[model samples]
Target: MNTTIIEHLACLEINNLILQPPFHLISNIQWNDKGLSFDGDIELYSSDIRKTDFIGRVPVQIKGTTTHKKQHKKSKIKHSVNKKDLEVYYKDGNGVLYFVVTINPNTHDRQAYYRSLAPLDLKGLLDKLEANGNDSITIPFKKLDNGHLERVCKTFIQVVEKQPKQYIEASNKMEFTDYTFNYADIQEDLFDPFEEPVYIYGVLENIEIPIETATLFEIRKKDNEVITIDHEEINVEYELKETKEVVSLIIENSLTCEFNKKKKTGKINLSSIRTLGSYLKCLKLIKYQLEHNKLPFKPFEVGAKINNKKDFKNVYDDIKMYEELIEICNKIGLRDNYVFNEGENLSSLFNGIIDIFKHKKYQLLNIGDNRKLENTMLYNLKLSDFITIKVMFVDNEFIDFFGEEILSKIGGLVPKKPINKTTAEWDPNNWEEIYFKASIYSNESIKELQKATNFSFENLKLSYTDQYHDIGIDMTINIALDFVNYFDESLDSRFMELALDLIQRYLRKFPDNDLGKINLYIIRFKQFNKLSEEEQEDILEILERAENENHKNICFACEVLLQNKLKARKLFSSLDIISQTTIKDFPIYRLYQNLG
Candidate 1:
C-alpha cells in the first residue's frame, strides 16, 4: 500500500475511535521521509508552508506526476513532511507523543512507510471519521496462506511496536508477544483482567480480598480553629497490639469547649476478634452432653461471654462440672493468670459476653443466618453465682429458646436480589451478553462453541485492534501514554472528545489544500516542547482541544457555586478572606494560604 494511503488510513481509524463514544483506538505508526524540499522552498510565506517546518510533522508531496513506474528512474527529490502528517501536539511543556505510521511495502525493503502523528486530537478525529462512516475498512487476515500470514504477522508486530508506553504499562503484566494464535494453545495465551488471587498464607494465586472495608479510614476536620484546639482529631490513628494474639484498637476523640473544668477521657473497646473465650464455651457444652450421656446436638459457639462474678459464686464450682474445659482452655493458649473483671457496669459485662459469643457462633453457621439467634441466645445462655443460683433458679428455668429452622432461614436472606431470568431473556440487548447458544448439543459442538465464544481475551484483541487494525489506536496511545496519562475511563472519554472536537474545528477552517491547522498544532506542541512539525496536523488540533476541555471540566467539578449572597458571604467570612474586594472577586482571583 502507498505510504500516503497508510497515513490517511491511520487518520481514519483515529477519527472512528473518537467519534464512536465508547470505543477507543490504539495505534502505533511512524511516517517515512520528509517531503521533497527545493532551495526555492526557503523564505516561503509563513502561511505558504516551509520545508524544514514540515520535516517530521506531516507528509506533504511536492505537486508533480510520475510516468512509467515499472521502468523506474531514480531522481533526487528532497522529501519533507507536510501539515497533514503532524497529527497531535501538547502545549504545556510535556514531552510530545508522535504517532509515526509505517507501512512496509516489501519485506526486502527495511525502510518502513512512516508518518509521525501528533499526540492525538481524539474528539476532533472521531467526529470527522464517524461523519465519514469510515470505520469498516477491510484488513486482509486469513491464516491459509503462509505468505499472507507472514505479512499480517509483520504488520501486527509493527502495530505493537507503535503502541505508546502507557498502554503497555496498564496492560496486565503477563506478556503476549510469544502467545500462539492457534485454538489449541488458547488457555496459555488467554489473559483475564478480572481473575482475583487466592491468599494461602498471604500468597495470592487466583483470588483477591476486597479492600472495601479494610483497616483504612477517612477523617475530616471542621476548621482551622477547631483543628488547632483538637489537633489529635485531625489525624486518625489505628494501633494493633501483639502482646498475645493480635488485637486491633480504634480510638476517636473530638474537642469540645465545655463549661466544666475537668478533662474526661472515655475509653471504648471497639471490638475483640480471635479471642480465647470462644474455646471455653465449646468445652463446657461438650462436657454437659457427656455427663448426661447424650450426643451433643451441636458444636458450642464461642462469641457468648461468661461472667465469673454474676455466673458463679466460686469459679471452681463451675470448673468442677466441666473439668475437661480446663484442658481445652489451656490447649488454646489461655493462661492461668487470664481474668476478665466485670465491674459495676452491668451492661458492659453483658455486652462483652454477647460480642464474644456471637463472633464464634456465627463462624460455625458460615453460610446461614445467625441473626435470628441473637435474641434467643441472649435469653437461653445464662450463668448465676452458686450462692445466688438457688434463688435465681427458683424464679427461672434455662433452655435454648430459638429453633434451628428459624435461625437457618434468617441467615439465608440475601441482601442483593437476583435478576429475573425471564425479564433478562426478553430484553434484546441482553443477547449481546450471551457467549454462544447453538442448539446442537454434541460434545464437539459444545467445545467449539465454548472455545470460539470466550471473551476472556477480548481486551487483548481490543488493544491489538486499536493499535494495529485501526489508525486511531496511534492517536489514542499518544494521549494515554505520552502526555497527560489518561489511565481511567473518565479521562479517556474527555480527552478523546476534546481532541475530536479540536480536529473538526481545524479542518473546517482549512481551504481544501491549505493545511495551516496542522502547522499551528505542531507549533503549539513545539511551544510546549512535544511534537515535531512532521506529524499529522489533524491529530495535533484534537489533542490540544481535549487537553483544554479536561482542565475546564476538572475546575467545574471541584468548584462550589455561590447559590445566594448569604451563603457566599458566610463562606467567605469563615474562609477568613483578608479583603472584601478579594471576596467580591473570589472567582476571578486566586488566593494563597500559609499553614505556618
Candidate 2:
C-alpha cells in the first residue's frame, strides 16, 4: 500500500467508459497564505479534450488516506484506470479508450487522481449530473460549521436501541421480583432495515453514564426451587464521534447504490456504504436548497437566517410548493446576476428549469487583454468534485461509458441504466412522405439527420448552437452512409434502400476519413428475402469462389435485382426477388454436401 492519499482517491475515480462525459477536475488546492494554488496538482485534469478551462496550472495537496482497499500479491497486482489517466490520455470524446493500469497497492507508483475544482460554475456541473440520472443535489466538499450542520440535519430522525434487560423490583417493594421483556429482543426484532439510518452511532443518546457495566440474567424455575440458567457481565464503551439534537421526522425517501464489495475470500453486498451516505448528504443539501429558495451556491446566507426550528418550518413549508426553486437560483447565478432575496414567491420566477443546477457557462475571451471572469475564476478551483457529485445523478449514457472502460479497469463492474426513459421507433417514416429517414442519401435533411445519426442531439445543442441544424443534418447523412447499407428488411425496405443510396452518394461526394459502417441493415435485408433464379445463381457462384473481400457487394447485387423488377412494374413491391430463388452454395447447403 505504498500510495498517496490522493492516489487512493484517484483509484476511486471512474476510468473505462463507453460514453464518458468531458470532465474538468480542479485538483484539490494546497491552501497557504495565498488564496488558491494551481501548478501540475493531482486534482486538476480534464477527461474531455474540448473542455479547456483549467489547463496548465492547478493547485495540488497531499491528502490524508481514507478506508480504501489495496491488494498485496504480485499475482493480484492487476492494472486499473483512474479518472486522471482517462482525461490525460484521450484526445477524442467518442471511441473505445483503454489505459493500461492496475489498482494493486504496489501499482500506485503509476496512478493519479482528481484535484482542482471550479467553484461558481457548480450549476453547470449539477445539470450534467442530473442529465445522467442523478436525483441528488451537490455541495462543495468544504467544511460545514456546527450551526450549518445543525440547520441541515434539523429534520432527521434518531432511533435508539438499548441493551438487553435485567429485571428489578419496584422502588417501594424491594423484596418482590417483577419480570419485564428483554431489550435485545425488541431492539433487533422491531426495527425495520428499509428505513435510512441518519447516523449509526454506538453511543446512547439518553443514557446518563457514558461508561457503564450492564448484566443479563436468565432465570429458570425447577419445581419449587428457583435457579439462574445463564448470566453474563458486559462492559460498554461509547465514544460519541458526532451528536445533534433530536429533530424527530419521518423517512422521506431512500436510494440504493447497488454495488458488490469484495470480502476476505469472496464477494459480498456492502450495506449502507457508498450511495446511502452520499444520498443522505444529497438530501441534506436538497433540504437546505428547499428552505432558502436558493441553489447550493451561497448556502451561508440561508444558514444565517434560518437558525431556529420556527424558521426551518417556514422554509420547509415553502419548499413543498416551490420544489424546483433551487434550479431557478442556479439559472440566475449562472446566466444572469443573482442577488439574495428574502421575500415570498421565490419559486415562481423560473419555470423552464430542468437542469439549471448544472454549472455550464458561455465565456467570452478578450484577445488583447487576457482577464478571467470572476465567476469562472471562482469555479475553476472546485470543478472536479462538482463533476463527481453531479455524475452520480446524471443520465446513463456517460455512466455506461465509464463503467465499462474505467470501473471495470480494476475488475470492478457497476451496472447503470439511463436515467431518462428512451423510446425507439422501428419506422422512420409515415403516411404520405418519408420526411424522417435513415438511409444512404447524397444529402440528408435536418429532420433525417437528427432521426438517424448516432451523434448526441443534446451535445450538438450545447456546443454547436448556431450551425447545429445545418451541420447536424449534413453530418447525419454522412455518418449514416458510412454504414454499408442504410436499411435492412427489419426496417422499411424502401426507406432503407433510398436512404442508403442517397447517403452513399453524399459520402462519395463528401467523404472524410473514417470508413462507413458495415451496414447491418443491408446485410439483414439480404438474408431473409428470396432472390430471382438468375440472381440466386450469381450469389452461389460468388460463394463458391471465396474471392469477394466485402459481403456488401453481394447484398447490393440482391437489392438491385429487387429494385429493377419493381421499377419495370411501375410500383413499389414489398417482396424481393431473392425470396423466389434458393442458393445451392449457401453455408447450410455446403454443410449438407460435406455430410453427404
Candidate 3:
C-alpha cells in the first residue's frame, strides 16, 4: 500500500478511540486542505444531560506514522513541525493536544503517543530552536499508555467548574457596601498603669445602623499556650432619625469586634485595622509587664524591658512587632502621616528614658538639688573637659532637652574671641594688649573669621596710623614667626602653610615696605622648602616683574630660599651695591657674596 493510504487508515482508528463514550469529537472540515493544522476539537461532557455548564474542550492535532525507533531499551517516536505552523497554533490562544499513532506492518498492532501544548510550551520550544540555531524542531514522545489523557480531562473539568463559584463570590463582594468609619473621630482615653482590662472608645459619627455595642480584646499567647486575656467593653447607644438611626460606640481599644449574647468576640489575629495609637498603648502595657517581672495572668514567662539594650533580643523583637503594626496601619487606609507622627513622639519618649539610664552610669550630671556643679556651667570649662561634657550629654540623651543654646555657648568658648574682629585698635605703646590681640590670630581663628565675615584673608582690611602702621606690622609678623616656630616644634605642616599665607597677603598689600619682609624672610624660607616645583616656577614669574630694588632684593632672596645654585649665582652677579640693612638681615647674604 502507498504511504498516504496507510497514514489515513491509522488516523481513522485514532478518531474512533476518541469518539468513545462521554467524549465528543468535532472534525475539522478543512483538515485535508489545511496542511499540518489541528485535526479536530474534543469535548467531554457531564454524565447528566440536564446540567448546562461548560465541561471542557481540547483542540487536537493527530499524526500517523508507521516508523518506530528503539533507544535505551525503550520504543519512542519523533515528529518534526515547522516554526511558522507552531507559532500560528499557539497564537490562537486555545491550547492544542497532539497524538501520534504507530502501527506494526505485519500484525497491524496500533500504539498511540499523546502530548499537550500550552502557549508557554510552544514558546519554550521556539526558544530551544533559536538556542540551537534552527528554524524547525523535532519533538519526541513516549507511548501514552499510563492513562495520562484521562487525567488531563479530569483537571480541565475541575478548573472550568471553579470559574462560576469564583464569579459569584466576586459579584457578591462588588455588591456589598462598607459603612463609613471616620478615623478622625476616634477618641482614646488614657488607662492607669495599675488598671486591668483597659477601657477605650472609638466615637463614631453619622451612624445609620442600630449598633448595640463595640468591643476590643487583647490576646496574649506563648508557644501556642494561652496567657493573660484582657478586653474592653464599650456601650453603644442609638437614636432614630427621619430616614436612619444614629449610633454612638465606645470600645476599649481601636480593634473592631462583634458582640452577641453580652459576650464580646473578635479574631485573635493581629490585623491591619489595629491603629498606631493602639499599638503604642500595647507597648506601654508590655513595659509595665517588664517592670513587674511577671505577666498579669499566671503560668507566663518573665518580661524584660523593651528599652533595655542588655536585653537586646527582646527589645529587637518588640521593635519588629511595632514595625509590623505600623505597616498594617499604613495598609488599611490609615494615613502614613499620622503613623509617622506617632512614631516620632514614641522615639523621643524612648530616647529620653534611655538617656536617664546612661547619665546614671556616667555620674556626669548631678541631678540632685544639693549638687556640687551646675549643668549650665559645663560650657565654660576647658576645651578637652568641655568636649568630654558634650559627649556625655549627647550619649546620655540630654542634648535635645537642654536645647541648642548650650551648644552655641560651648562653641563660643572653644575660641578665644569672636571671628568678626578684624583689627586690634589698641594704643601702639600698649604692648600687652597688642600681644593679646595677636595671640588670637591663628589658622582656626582666621578660617572662622573668613566664614563669619564672608571675606578672604587677603581682603581683610587693617587700618593703622603712620606710626602705628610699623608697630602693627611688626606685631603681625612676630605672630607669624611664633606660629612658624610652633609648626617646627609640633611638625604641623598646616601651621607653616597658614603662617606663610598670612605673611604673603601682608607683603602683597604693602610691597614697598621692606620691614615686614625682612622680619619674615627666615620663616618664609622655612615655608618655601615645602612648595612644589610648579609653585617655585609661579614665584619666579612673579619676581620677573620686579620694579624697585626692594622687590629685586626679594626676588634674589627667593632664589636663595629655593636653593637654586644657577639662579642665585646669576642674581648675585647682576646686583649693584646693596643696602646695609639687607646685607645684615638676609640669611643667605654670605652665600650671595661668595657667588659674586
Candidate 4:
C-alpha cells in the first residue's frame, strides 16, 4: 500500500463523483485539490478535485471499509467519518450530500452509499457521537443509486427550509419565524411515519433568557399549558396579511402552519385532521416558499401585548408586554408552586396560584396537571396546630375562617391535603412533657383524620390500646381539636379558652365519652390569672366531677393550676398509680405546664 497511490485513488474517487450524473447535475457544486481554507474554500468547501450539479448546492462525504451487504435496495458501507468534516458540513447553508463510494480493485465497479448528514440530523447525534478523536464517526451509509436521488433532494429541502434564516446570535431578546407543514392538514391514512418529522421552525429575538426549543409547538409540554379544557383546538392563522389576496391560489389543501410565541418559547399545535385533505406532513414548505411570491410564515410584522389574563388566550408575540409581565412577576418573587383545589371558586384558586407562580416560571396556567400537582404539594406540606377545616359547607364559597386563613382562601382542606400530622399532648402528671395522641390510633387513622379535618363521617376509624381497642374515635377527635384551635399563641388565656371551647363542641357530639376531653388541658394552668372568675369556675367544675382515673388526673392538674399544692398532692395521692399519672397528651402542651 503506497501513500502516494492511496492519495491518487482518493483523488480519482472525488473526480468520478464530480463528473457523475446526479452530482454533475447540481450547479454550484465542485471539488478542489489545493487548499483554499480547509484543504479546499469557505474553509470546508475550499479545495476538492471534482464537482457536479444536483437539485441545489450540496456538500458530500463518503465512508466505507470496502465491504457491502444488501438489505432490500440499500447496502451498508461501514467507514469512519471525521468529526471536523461533519461540523463543516452542518455549518454550510446547504446540507451535505455525503456518499460512500467503493470501487472494486479487480472489476473497477463503483458502489455509492449515503447517510443523511443534515444540520438537524447531525445536531441530534452530535452528543451521541463516539470520541475517536478526528475520526469519531463510523457511519452506516445506505446505498444511494439513481432511483432515490429525488427523495434525497426532497428530504434535504425539508431539513434546510425550516432552519431559521438566521441562527440566533445573542442568548437574550431574540426571535425568528419558521415554516413547516401544519399537522392540522394531516390525513392519517396517507402519512408515512418512517419519514423524518419536520420541525415547526421560527427565529427568536431579544428573549430576556433564552430557552432551547426545536419548534413553536414545544413551548407547551401539552396542549393545556396554553389553553383551557373548553377549547378543543387553538387555530392561529399564518396569513399573508401583506397581500390579503382574495384569489386563494388553490394549493394541495387549505394547509396552514401555526406559531405559538410563549414568553420563553413558542409552539404550534394540531387542531383537527381530515381524511380528505392531502397529508400536510408530505408538503415541502421550502419548495412552496421558493415557488411562491411571499413566505408562508414571517416575523411579527404587527405589534401586540399580553398585559392581562385575557391576553394569554391569544397566541401572538408581544415583546414589551412579555417583558413587563416578567418584570412584575420577578419583582414580586413568585416561586415554584401548586395551586388551589379544582372544586374551589375559580377566583380564589387563581389568587392562590398567582402568588406562587409568574415564577417557577414554568406554566402560565396549570390546568391539566391539577391532580399531580395537588398530590406533590400535599406530600411536601407541613402545617402547625392551627388549620381549621370546614365541618359543613352550605356552598363551596365558604372558607374555614376560624383561623386567619393563610395557605388558601380559607385554610385549604385535606382529603385534599395530607393527614400525616399527629397531634401531641402534655403529660398530665409531668407538666413539662407531652406525648403524641395520634400514635394510639390504628394505621387507618389517616382516613379518620381526613374525616375529622373534612368533618366527613364516612368510614370513620378508631384506635386500639394493647388492652382495649376503642381509642380511635377519641384520638381522631383530639387530632381535629388540635388543628382547629385558632387562639392567639401569645395569649395563654385565649389558648386555654380555645382548648375548653373545642372540647365543649366535641362533648356535644360524644357526650358519653366526656373523659376523652382530658387531652385538651395542655390548656395552660399558668393562665389561671388570665381567666375571668366564671372561666376559672367552669374549668374547676369540669375537673371536680371527674368519673375515672384519667379524669381525676385532670382534677389534680387543676388543683395545681389554682396553686392549691396541698390539695393537689392530696388529690394525686388518693388515686391509683394509673389514675395519678398523665392520661391525655395535647399539641399545646406548653399551655398546661406545672405552676411550679
Candidate 5:
C-alpha cells in the first residue's frame, strides 16, 4: 500500500480502539478539502453499567504522519496542517486536535504515535510557524502505546468531571415569633447553570413587634429585569398577627430598593439602605417590647428611643445627632414634606429648622457658620443682627468681586461681648461695638458690607461717625496713615483714589486739625510741590502753627513732606530740649530720625 493508504489504515485502527467502552465516536462525515471535516466528536460515558450515561463531548481533528527519524537528536514527526484549519480549531472553544504518526508505514509492523492538543498547545505551534516563516506548522507527537493511550483517556474523563454541576439543591431552616410572619420566599430567574448552591432564610415580622434578625438581600439587573438565581422563585414573608399595615420589600436593582409600610413607601439607594434596614428592624423590636409589657431591654429599643427624640436640645447638643433622626425618617418611609418642629432650646430649634431646611432641599451658601442660620429668620431679625449674620455667609464670588482681604476678615469676626441678654433685651448700640471689632470703617470692609447689605458705602460712611463717635474718625485716619507709610509705585490706582478720598473727607470735616494735616502731608508728599499756590500756603500755615504750638511730631512730619532731611532732624533735636516727654512717645520722631 502507498503512504496515504497506510496512514488511512492506521487512523481506522485508532478510531476502532477509541470506540471500545467509555467513548462514542462518530465518523464517516465529509470534511473540507483539507481532509475530514473532523475525525469525530468523542462523547464520554460512564463505564460501570451497561446503560450508557453521557457526560460531555469533545470535538477533535486528526492528522496522520508516517516519516519518523531522529532530527536534531530527537525523534521527529512532521505533519503539515492548513493555517486556516489550525486557526479555526484554536478558536473553536469546544474543539481539540489529535496528531497521529505511524512509524515504518511500509512494513506491516507499523506503530502509531499521537498527541492530543491542549488549550495552550496552539501557542507553541504558532511560534513554530513564525520561527520557520512557513504557512503550515509541524507538531511533534509522542508514541501512542497502550499505557499512554489509557492515561490520555483517563485525563479526558477527569477534565469532564471537573466542570461545574448543571443543577443545585439548597435549603435553610429559620424560626420566628407568633406575632410575626414565619417565612420568606423569593423567586428569581437566573438563566445560567449553577456553579454553587444558594440558601436564603429570614423571618418577617410586623412593625408592632420588636425582633432582631440578620439577613442578606441583594438585587442585580440583567436584560432589564431583576435576576438572582436562575428563574427560581424566592419567597420571603414576615407574618404579623392582628396588624392592618401591609409591608412589602421591593427590589428594583443593585443600587435601588424600596420598603413600604401601609400607604408609605421610601426608595433607598445602596449607600443608605443598611442604616435604613437597621432602623426598621429596631422599630419592629420596639413594638414587640411594648406589646409584651417588657422593659424595652433590646439594644435597638434604646437606640430607637434615643434616635426618635422630637425635642431639639437632644439633637443639637451632639453634632452627629441629626444623622439618627434622618435614619428614623428613612426607616419610617417619611415623605419629603414631613415637618420637623422646633425644639425648646435655641440650639435645638436651630437644628430642627435645619432639618426642615434640608428636607426642603434649600441650598445655603456656606459663608462660614451662617449656614446654621435659616433663611426664614433672615427677614425677621433686626437690621444690625441681619447684617452681622449676612457677613458670615458671603460666597467666594462676592469676595472676588470686592477684591479685599479686610472684608473676609470682617466677615469672620465674632462679637467679643457675650450674648448674655435675651433677643428681646439686645441693645441696638451693641452692633457698633461689634462693627468696630470687625474693622467696619476700613474701606474694603465698607465696600463688602455695601455689597452684602445693599446699602451704599457712603451711607455706611455717614453712619460710622453717628454710631461710633471719635472711634470712627480714628479708624479712618489710622487707615489713611497706613496708606501713607506703605505707599508704593505699584499700588492700584483705584485704591490710591480711595485713600486720597478718605484723607480729604477727614480734612474737610476738620480742615486745620493737626492729625488731619499730618495725614495729608504724608499722603501728598510726592505731589506737595505740585499743589496749587493756595494749597501750598495753607499747608505752610498748618506747619507754622504746629511749630509755634510745640507740636514737634506734627512739625517733623510736615517738614519730612518737604523732602528736607536737615530740617526734619533739627526739629527732632529741638523737641528734645523743649518737650518734657521722650521722643519715643512720638512715632513720627523716630520716623524722621531714621530718615535723617
Candidate 6:
C-alpha cells in the first residue's frame, strides 16, 4: 500500500506497454527518478530502433496513488502537479502529457489515465492562476489505453516541434537558467496588403546585453579633421549606465558586434564573458529584468519598412520570416550564428525557402482592390508595362505548385517559364528574376516598433524600393562613379555583385586600366559608412596595397570613401576643370561645396 510502490508500478506499466507487441514498436519511453518539468521523455521513431529515424520527442510526467474508492470520477484519475512545474511548462508554450495511474489498495489493480495539456489549454489554466493567487493545479487526467499509445505520443511530438523554440547548445558549458529552460514564444502577428500574413519566428532569443564603449559610436567629423585609424584602434572609456562606473575598453575592428547582412551571419564576442555558463545566468537575469520593464535597451534592434498604418502588418510578417530564417541556422546544427557562404551546399531549410519563391504562384487579380500593380524601371520599358508584387502563403507551409488552381486566372511571366517550378536564371543583364526575397521598411513599422519595445525609437527612412532600378549599367569612369555615389544604399547586393563581375570582365580585356580598378574598388566595397568596422578594415587594407604599388589614383579613391576631402579634392581637381556635375554623380564634391 506504499505510495512509492504504486508510483513504481505505474512507471512499470508504461514500460511494459512499450515493450509488449501488437501495439507496434515505433515508440519508446524513458523514465527518470524525479522530474523538474517532466518525469521523462517519450521518443517516436519512424523505424523500430534507429536514432536516425527519430521523428520527435514528447515530454512526459506521471503520478500514481492507491485509492479505496477515494472520490473517483468516471474514467478519470485526479492528481496535483507542482505550481512551479506548471509555470515552467506554461512559459515554454509546448504541450506536455500528464499521466495518472490509480491502484486499488487491496488488489493493487491499476488503471492509467492521461490528459494532454496543449499550449492553449495551458495558457487558459495559467491565465486563471495568474488572475487568482498563484497555486498548483489538480488535473483530472482522462482515460488512456494501449490502443491510444502511439496516437498520444505522435500528437505531443508534433506539438513540441511546431512550438517556436530558439534552442542552441552553447559552444561552451553554461549555467542553466530561465533562458535555457524556458520555451520561447512567437510574440504576435501582422498582415500586409499585397501579401497575406507570413509567420516569422526568431532563431535568436533572450540574447544577453553586451556593453559597448562610447567610442564604438562615432560622429562624422569636419572634412579637414578626418582622422584615420588602422585595424586595431584606441582605448575608449565605457561608463555603465546603471552603475555609472567608467572602464576602459580596447576597440578592435574585428571585435565590432553587428549582423553581417553581406554574409547573412552574426557573432558574439565571448572574450568579455569568462565562460558560456556565466552568459546563461546573465541571460536569465536580463530576461527577468526586461519582463519587469527595467532594462533600458534590448540586445539588438530590428528595422522594417511599412508604408501605411495597415502596412505595419507587412513589417510583422517580414520580421517573422527573418526569425524563421535565423531558425534555419539553428536547425542546420552548424555554427552558433548565421553563415551563408557562396558554393556551400544549401540545407533542406534553404530548399524550403527557395521552394517558396522558385515555385509558389499567385493568381494575378484583375479586379478592383485586389488588383495591385506598380511601376518597376527594370521591367518598365522592356519586360512588362505592369508588375504586381504577389506573395503567396497558405496552410502554414509553402504550398507546392502541383495541382494548383492558378491556370485559368492567367497573367504574364517575365521571360516566361513553366507554372510549376521555374529554373529561371538569376541574371542581372536580362532581369530574369521574377521571384526573390526583399527586406522592406516603413513608417507604420516604426510606430509598432514603439509599441513593442521599452527602448528608444528612432525614425529611420528605409531606402525606398526603387522603381527606377535597371541593369547593364554603363561602365565609363564617370558613370561608374555615379552608380556608386547615387545608389550606394539602395543598390541591391545582387546588382552590386553583378557590377563587380562586369568590372572583372572589363579588367580582363583592358588589364592595365586604373579606372577599371578604381570602379571595382568603388562599387565592390561601396558605402563606406554602411560597412562594419571589420569590413572597413578590409577596404583600408586593400588601399594600403595600392599605395605600396604606387597606384596614386586608387589610393586617392580610398580617401573619397574615407571622406578625406582635403586629400581626395587635391587628386580630383587635376581632372575636372569645369566641375559640371551634381553631388549624386560624385558625392566627394561635398568637400568642395561645403566649408566648416
Q: Which number leads on lDDT? A: 3
Encode model 3's per-residue lDDT on 121-215: one tens digit a residue: 45556667778978788876545543345445554344333223223223333422433221111113311122111212222353222111112
Candidate 6 is scored at a TM of 0.28
User: How would the candidate models be sorted by TM-score, starting from the highest?
Assistant: 6, 4, 3, 5, 2, 1
Residue 574, model 4: lDDT of 83
Question: What is the C-alpha RMSD, rounded to one decimal, of candidate 2?
Answer: 34.0
- The residue ranges of model 2 lying beyond 4 angstroms of the native Cα positions read 1-477, 481-596
lDDT of each: 0.26, 0.27, 0.44, 0.38, 0.42, 0.43
Measured on C-alpha atoms, candidate 6 has an lDDT of 0.43
Any runs in candidate 3 off by more than 4 Å, and if so which? 22-36, 48-53, 68-76, 146-148, 154-596
lDDT per residue for candidate 4 within 1-596, as digits (tens), equals: 34344334544554444444433233332344343213221111122334422234444443332324333234444666666666666566454666556654444455666665555555544545654333466655555544455455555555555443234223225444533342211224333222323333333342222122232222211111111112332222232311111112222223432323333322222222221112222122222332342333233222222224342242233323333443432222211121223343534432433443333422333435633333112121111132223221212212221112211221211121123443343344742222323222233333334433322221121111212222233444554444333233334243345446445555666764534444443343333335556646765666767644456666765665555677766766787866534432333223334445
Report, for all candidates in order, the number of backbone clashes.
Answer: 89, 81, 2, 50, 31, 12
Candidate 3's TM-score: 0.25
Model 2 vs. true fold: TM = 0.18
Candidate 1 lDDT (Cα, 0 to 1):
0.26
Candidate 4 or 3, higher lDDT: 3
Query: Taking the tens digit of each residue's C-alpha lDDT, what string does model 6 give over 38-153?
Result: 77667666765577777776667778777777423455555777767777776665667877777787877777777776554465566667787768777556666566666667
Candidate 3 — worst ten consecutive residues by lDDT sum? 238-247
Residue-level lDDT tens digits of model 2 in 132-196: 75543332122211122111111110111121111111122223232222121112322222221
* Cα-based TM-score, every candidate: 0.15, 0.18, 0.25, 0.28, 0.25, 0.28
RMSD of each: 35.8, 34.0, 25.4, 23.9, 26.3, 26.8
**In lDDT terms, how accurate is model 4?**
0.38
